[model samples]
Target: MKKSIFLLALVIVFSSCNNTQKIAEITPNEIPSGNYEIKSIQGEPVYKLSFDVDTSENKISGKTNCNSYSGTFSLTNNKIEIGPLSATEMYCEENVMKVEHSLFEAFSNAKTFVYDNNMFVLSSETGIVLRAFRIVKK
Candidate 1:
């Protein structure tokens, strides 16, 4: 009886851990299509950009205040790849440029991303969190 009880407890623990791991794994298909606004980075207000994902084109495009940019994106097994980003050279106001630069740097360096409900978060291997909010359609 004691052995059976111990086995049951172990099974329960293992099952719970598996569920948690699954929850943490978010797929790109789960990400909604819409505009997302940068909210905070590492728990601080940083830069804001609007990201519009075009699944048909397998691209994510938007404006970062300083310029308009677009990039091809792919996801496999919950892993994200964003690259080949191309943008215009038009300049903007000082504040806008600052924000745009910050946003661009963050996106360029993002190693992993997760989309949860209305929030899309980017994180690095070291666990830095960059949060964004989905813009409501008007």
Candidate 2:
């Protein structure tokens, strides 16, 4: 009887551990579309930088250190592609140009994005590229 009880408990335990629970993927259609105020790039803090995302139109526009940039982008299965961008030709200070260089590096690489906890994070395979919070419209 003890052996039979042990077997029953084992079956119950095994049945309770259901490995079939599906994790829903955030589809491209669900990618947030709006203006996100960037707070950091390459894990370094910065201010006065932001991106305007229009997912429906596959467009991204934002400010660099001294230039206003526009680009095409796509998001699929949380992976991101930002690029082929054009920007205004205003010369900036050295510090501002440094920030723009970092921004361009992040823009010209492989990236993945996540919108969570009210924060939008763009990351590369090595580490985080930038982090931002969406500007909610009132």
Candidate 3:
């Protein structure tokens, strides 16, 4: 009886570990489709920038400040890639440019994203989170 109980406990522990690991993996469906807005930049508040994600075309197009930028993006289990972003060359004030640069860099380097309900959070490998809100269509 004691041996059987010990085996049961071991099985329970292994099963729990598997469940935890699975939770860490990001599923494809967790990524939302449609428009989004940047609610925060690098864990700080900033002017909202709208984003439109086309999962079918594997593209992410968005408006940052007064400039529009588009780029290719890919998302897999626990991984995200946004790169090769092309934007208008129009210049802006120093403060606005700083925010634009930070947003662009953060999005470009986002390695993972977590979405719950209509709220989306993008994070880098180092755990910096950029939160965004889903834009409801009229």
Q: Against the hidden reference, what TM-scores do the models get?
A: 0.67, 0.75, 0.75
Each prediction's Cα lDDT score? 0.73, 0.83, 0.81
Global local distance difference test of model 3: 0.81
Across 1-138, the per-residue lDDT of candidate 1 in tens digits comes to 999999999999998887643333435546666788878765568655568877667788888766999888776645567777888989889988767666666666677777767788877666655688888665
How well is each residue in 1-138 modelled by candidate 3, as lDDT tens digits?
A: 999999999999998887643434335446766898888888889766778888779888887776889999887775788888999988988888888898898988799988776788888988765788888676
Residue 108 local lDDT, model 1: 67
Candidate 2: minimum summed lDDT over ten consecutive residues — where?
23-32
Cα displacement (Å) at residue 119, model 3: 1.2
How would you encode candidate 2's per-residue C-alpha lDDT over 72-125 as one tens digit per residue? 988777888998889898999999999988887887774788887558888898
Backbone clashes for every candidate come to 0, 0, 0
Q: How close is candidate 1 to the true structure, as a TM-score?
A: 0.67
For candidate 2, the per-residue lDDT at 95 reads: 97
Q: Once superposed on the true structure, which residue ranges of model 3 sit more than 4 Å away at CA?
A: 1-29
Show model 2 residue runs off by greater than 4 Å.
Answer: 1-29
Candidate 1's error at 21, in angstroms? Answer: 31
Clashing pairs in 1: none
